[model samples]
Target: MMTTMIRVVLPAHLRTLARVESEVRLDVPLDAEGRLTQRAILDALEARYPMLRGTIRDHVTQQRRSFLRFFACAEDLSLEPPDAPLPDAVASGAEPFFVVGAIAGG
Candidate 1:
């Protein structure tokens, strides 16, 4: 069965590191009931953007790496877990998923 598509936007440094110019799009891995989860979305995103390998998660711990953020529907998802469910708009392809590198300074 076909599923909806989600657009993932990456930060500039990540884009340069990944050597990708356009936004990354993925198919929501839907279940029998058509429910889509963040884990599924992230898995697909990582698979498609191999250069983004450790940019979001720690290569050793598999934990969320520092300086990365996830956003959708104007909500900041920097601290959200990998398995957290996203908004319906994002899951249903009405909105795009964002993975941005956090800025730091003092």
Candidate 2:
């Protein structure tokens, strides 16, 4: 299995939950087509940090949590297809994938 190291920045709460102080570097595996996707990144993250398995996405439905958002290269990727390839900057490590916890108040 071929793999690439990806940089990911988690929200403060998640960072605390994962016990990581800085951005996380994960060895994400490529799919059968030799392409990396958001699903692959999230899968590798959960695999490496078991505690984050269901925190970012639903364990059963695999849907991103409503309170969470994903971004890369200054673009919002929260609604992007899971199989879609991330931006070249993100794939090449020029930018870090951001997992942000949304805040709402009135």
> RMSDs, each prediction?
2.3, 1.5
Candidate 2 lDDT by residue in tens digits, 2-90: 88787999999889999998899988887787777999999989989999999999999999999999999889999999999888677
TM-score of each: 0.81, 0.93
Flag regions of model 2 displaced more than 4 Å: none
lDDT of each: 0.76, 0.90
Q: Compute the lDDT for candidate 1.
A: 0.76
- Which candidate should be chosen as best, given lDDT against the real structure? 2
Candidate 1 displacement at residue 29 in angstroms: 0.9
Error of 2 at 81 (Å): 0.9
Off by over 4 Å in 1: 31-33
lDDT of each residue in 47-70, candidate 1, tens digit only? 877877777888778777777777
List clashing residue pairs in candidate 1: none
Error of 1 at 97 (Å): 0.9
**TM-score, predicted candidate 2 vs. hidden true structure:** 0.93
